[model samples]
Target: MVIQEQIRIQTRGRNTYNITGEVSEAIGRAGIETGICQLFIQHTSASLILCENADPSVRTDLERIMSRLVPDGDPIFDHTLEGPDDMPAHVRSILTHMDLSLPISQGRPALGTWQGIYLWEHRTHPHQRNVTLTL
Candidate 1:
């Protein structure tokens, strides 16, 4: 069986949003006991990741490191029509992943304890991000 759906995520600027519960709920609705769960984010300035959701510091550190690596307002970037964060956001997305594949078992995503799926919004402002889940 194949089940597909789109999940809208309201992001709070540049941050990591845990979407594990939403994906799990979708998986439950799919009723696929044993299969592969594929997730794709339909945005250029945003990406996806599977990381440790146990501590807030983990995400904070990631944000800090990424900001340092891809600092906004770089004079080298030519794509500054949107804002200082425009090119940086795209660079961040390039550094990360646009899709993820997880195992489904017992009608649920087989994520390990302390691990969770996330939408890493790289924009400087809030935006509605769309993630498509296929099970």
Candidate 2:
């Protein structure tokens, strides 16, 4: 059998926010001995990614790449409900990931030695993010 849990977070966009601990905690609480832990972000403007768990510089580079790929305000964007980053966030999300699947072992997510799950918020301000964990 599988269990599902929703972990909520409010974050300031423009950087990588580590969610490994949160997911692991959820998985631990789920009490699954062996299964796949699936994580999905329920927003078009939000994204998910697996990144380096130890170093912060990796996250900095990721933020830089995002800025270069999706500038704050581009002339091609039409949807700007929240601000300049609103549409860009959608584009970033499209370019990035929306879901992830991780292995579960001993009631925990089976991550590598230096692997971490991150919530990549691309918005312009602080926003609430919902991370759905289906194990």
Per-residue CA lDDT of model 2 for 1-135, tens digit only, reads 868899998897666788988998898887888999999999999899999978899988888988889898898888877889888899899999999999999888888899999999888788899989898
User: Could you tell me how far off, in angstroms, the CA of residue 12 lies in candidate 1 after the best superposition?
Assistant: 1.8
| Cα-based TM-score, every candidate | 0.98, 0.95
| Candidate 2 residue spans exceeding 4 A from truth | none
Residue 99 CA displacement from its true place in model 1, Å: 0.2
Q: After superposition, how far is residue 34 of candidate 1 from its true place, in Å?
A: 0.9
Against the hidden true structure, what lDDT does model 2 obtain?
0.88
List, residue by residue over 42-107, the lDDT tens digit for candidate 1.
999999999999998999999999989999999989999899999999999999999999999898
Native-to-model Cα distance after best TM-score fit, residue 111 in candidate 1, in Å: 0.9
Reference-based lDDT, each prediction: 0.95, 0.88
Worst 10 residues of 1 by lDDT: 24-33
Best by the TM-score measure: 1
